[model samples]
Structure formats: structure tokens, C-alpha cells
Target: MASELPMEEIVRRGARTNFEGLRESSFVPLFLTLWGRQASDDHVRQQLKRHYESVTDHLVGVYADFFESQGWDPRPPFTIRDFAVTLTALVEGLTVRWAVDPDAVPLEMRSVQSSMRVERQDDLDAGPWDLFGIVVLALIPSMTVPRIKRDSELWADHEDVRGLVRRLRETWESMVGLSPPAEAPDHTAPESADHCGAEPRRT
Candidate 1:
């Protein structure tokens, strides 16, 4: 059912789901701490590795579908698999920070006006959600623009690329002016099962 949604919708839903789970459980943090200290333990390391691999594989498939639906080719130099791995790494790094200090890390989804508070680096009270927005904005253009340019079908002329760049710039500017939201959006809403193609079964 989830596989039928647009890429943006899927990502939003997944993030909401993850935030809810993390809020309800301390297990993820405890496991990460233990894994960091017990890196030499083959059994524990293998379990963690397997989990990451599974997530990466799932993301790759999702991204491949997304790119295809956008009229973009999922080929080398900017492959869906590589993008998934990078995205997974980004999320894991953010999770580590959240685990260390949940309050300081903003993972919710409310109006930016409610949570734009900032503090010094030493104070460690910076708005992480704002940081996330900046990082994502920077990453999307750097990653996708080149790929879109490489494919003639995706980019008909200079105007097309320029239009994308202009939109990106506008979004970045707007994001810079806002802060992270305080509450997460509802993730319990039902999604359609209208698969664009054969949906892969998740493990």
C-alpha cells in the first residue's frame, strides 16, 4: 500500500512512523550504544549490519520507482542504489544525534513558527530540524540536477534545468527563513494500493 504513494509522500510517512517509534521506545538508543561499544562482537555487529542492508535495499527499490515515475533514468553515476545508501547514512547519522539528546533534536512536523529557537554550539540547543531542511535542500539539487541534465528526456532545454534550479533556490531561501515544527503530522491516514508496477515484497 505504501509503495503506491509518491516519493515525497512515502518519505514523509516513513519519517513520521520512525519518529513515533523512537518516541515510544528507548530500545533503539540502547542498542546503538551497545553496538558502538561492542563492535568487536561478531554476532551483534552482524545483526546491525543485516538491519542496515535490509533498509538500504528497500530504499533503493523505492527510489528506483520514484525516479522512473519522474521520467528520470535510474542508471549509474547517480544510481538509485547509491542514492539510497547515502540517504540511509544521512538518516542514521541524524538518529545517532537524536538518540544522544532527543529534546535538542527536532523530528516533528508542525508550523515553523512554533519552533525556531536557536542557541550557541556549546549550548547544544540548535534546531536540528532546521539543519535537516538545509541539508536536504543542498543535497537534492547537487544530486538530481546533474542526473536530470544527463537525460535529454528529463531536460528538454536550458529552460527546464533553469526552472528546476530556480525552484530549488526559492525553496532554499524560504526554508532558511523558517524553523522546525513542534508536532509531527498524522501518519495513520490510509494510503492507496494503486501500484504503478509490481511492488516488491518487503522483508
Candidate 2:
């Protein structure tokens, strides 16, 4: 049956169909799907550090596909590090008033010390910057990043996307807010002070 229809046609058909029962779908199947495709999935419990060294590309592709599949089109024009900053801003934006206080969203995780320095055994060397490069590995999966400018046609046409991201953000905002504000995009890479040492972007 699967072979009877072309893959793209099947996906389009699914898009048009009125199938039900997917509202409460779990994420395990999806994550396992990406991991299954990459033989070097070190996220497996107790993976040695060396395993990550060989699978960086696999991980990045897995995450990139995850984001694109979620309709986060028109990606930012910056390095993965910059993209991380933008993504963080988007996911953690919107400072709402606390349920009781008239001042602002209570900084629940801001004051009491919420592991300032999380140590990952593998640099797998992934850093905070990896957030932009790898959305799939977020502590929680999301379809959008808050605060980041989503393009002109967005604010009006993408209410569903906006609502999804807004709620995802609000849900997490009380827990741990987004890092940097979506003020502006950074064009240069931090390590590019020596641009004389590298090549240029094709675009």
C-alpha cells in the first residue's frame, strides 16, 4: 500500500485528509526516528564522548529537518551561533504579569540558582550556541522560537503558529525565561575577528 503512492503525493494527501486521533501523539516515535537514521546517535544513555565527535553533522541535520518540518521557514541569516541567540529570544520572550503581582512575570528560575553552569559530558562540545543549530535536542520540542522576527506576512497570517509559540513560551516563561531579547541580528561570527583567515559567504 505504501508503495502505491509517491512519497510526496502521500504527504500532500495526508495534508488534505481529515484523519483524526493525532492530537495526543507522543514525541518518542519521532525522536527515535531521527536517532534510528543516524547510526551514531550518542543521546543513547551512557554514550561515550568519542561517539559524538563522529556524528555532529548527523545531529545538526536531524535538528534542521525537525525545525523546517515544523514550518519555521525563512531561516535567519547568520551563523548557527547567532541562530541560537535568535531562537532563544523567540522561545523565551513575552514578559507577562505574574498571576498575583501587578509588576511583571515572576522570575522563578532567575534568582534561586538554577544550575548556572550545566556540564554536558560531551562537547559533543555542543554549547548554548548549539541551540540554534539543534532544535531537536531542546529540553522540550517546539514549533517556533519567540521574540525573533518571523517575517512581514507572519503576524497576520500565522495566528496558529503565533499562538502555538506564544503558549509554549508562556508555559516556559514562568519556569525559565528566554535568554536574549530579539533586538537585532548579529552578522559577524564571534570568532570571525580574523576574517582574513576564512572564505566568504556565497549569498
Candidate 3:
């Protein structure tokens, strides 16, 4: 099903859908509480652990498909598994923080405001799900870098991911009627730099 959509669209849709589920569902918190309290119960712990693993596995499969659709290989030094685990951890951790204190992080409020502006709506009308989606979007890029950098060769071919992120940010800016930021200078080394010396010279 994810194959039908562009990677960017798939990411946006997935983020929004999952964000909504997390925000509106009490079952998530209930389950987390149960896991925390029942950690010493082997049966309960095993069940919860399996459930979490299954969910992360499914996310890895989706990411694998997305990478394949873009002609990118989802394998070591960092694989879809790595991406999935990291992404899920970020989402879960942030959701807990937001649940505890919506304004615990100033970025959370800023993301909500940015999303509202993009939607051309007031905060009251935006709803918690919309704010959650905004937070996910804001967090995805930074989380992606570690996986991308793990294999420089693979990353070179998949550099489009960076551009895609930039475009997404620009889209939000345009929606909110703001000027896009100036492009930063490229500081990346040339392919041949690897052969030049042990360390590439700075430009």
C-alpha cells in the first residue's frame, strides 16, 4: 500500500496517522503503565516485549519498501531495522513527554504553532492530532541522519532524502506565507577526496 505513494507523502501521512492514534488513544498509556508495573512478571513482560517488537518490525518493513521504491538499499551499516528502532523510540519518548507536560519542551509549542500557521487555522481549531503530526515532522529529519551517515557510500546515492526534508520544510514555510531560508554552502567532500589523503582538505 505504501508503494503507491511518494516517499515524502508516505512519511507525512504515516506521521499524521500515527500521531492521531497516539494522541487520542488511552490504550497506549495504559499499556505503558502495565508494562512498567508488570516488568517482574515474566509472562506479561514477554507479551509486551513481543508486541513492541512486532510493531517495530512492521515499521522496518514499511521503511524497507520506501527505500526500495527510491532505488535505495536498506541494509548495513545501518538498515531499515536501525531506522525503525530509532524512529519509534523518538516518537514514544516524545509522546510520553508531551503527555506529561504539553509545554515541557518549547519546541513542542513552536511546532504546534507552525502547524497551525501552515494550516491557516487557529490553535483552538487545530486539535491535538494536528499538533502531534507537526511534532513528528519536526523530529524526523534529525533522527534520520545517524542512519544515513552510517554508510557513506549508500548515503551518497540516497542524498535525495536530505533534499526531500528541505523541500518539506519549505512547503511548510510557503503554506505559512514565510520566505524560505537561504541555502547553506555545501561543505561536503568530493568523491575523489577519499583518495587524496587520510583526511579531505577543508574548502
- lDDT order of candidates, best first? 3, 1, 2
Top lDDT: which candidate number? 3
TM-scores of all models? 0.48, 0.20, 0.52
- Clash counts per candidate, in order, are 1, 6, 0
Point out where model 1 deviates above 4 Å: 1-14, 22-27, 74-76, 108-134, 145-203
Give the per-residue lDDT digits (tens) of candidate 1, residues 1-203. Answer: 22444443344454545545554676667767768866678888887788878988887787666666655553334566777777666655666787678776676434552444332335333333333443443455435533356554333333444565555566676779854356886667655574436586688
List pairs with backbone clashes in candidate 3. none
> Rank order by TM-score, top first?
3, 1, 2
lDDT of 3 by residue, 1-203 (tens): 43544444455567667755776778778878877867688888888779889998899888776665655564334566777876777667667877788675333344344444333344223333344455555544433443335443423334456554565667788899999777986668464647666675689
lDDT of 2: 0.36
TM-score, prediction 1? 0.48
Candidate models: Cα lDDT each: 0.56, 0.36, 0.60
Model 1: ten consecutive residues of lowest lDDT = 119-128
The model with the greatest TM-score is 3
lDDT of 2 by residue, 1-203 (tens): 22333322333233222111121235334533555655665455224224333344443454455445544432223233333434333322311122234244322223322332334443222112211112222322233343444554333333544455565566676678655356686666466545667667676
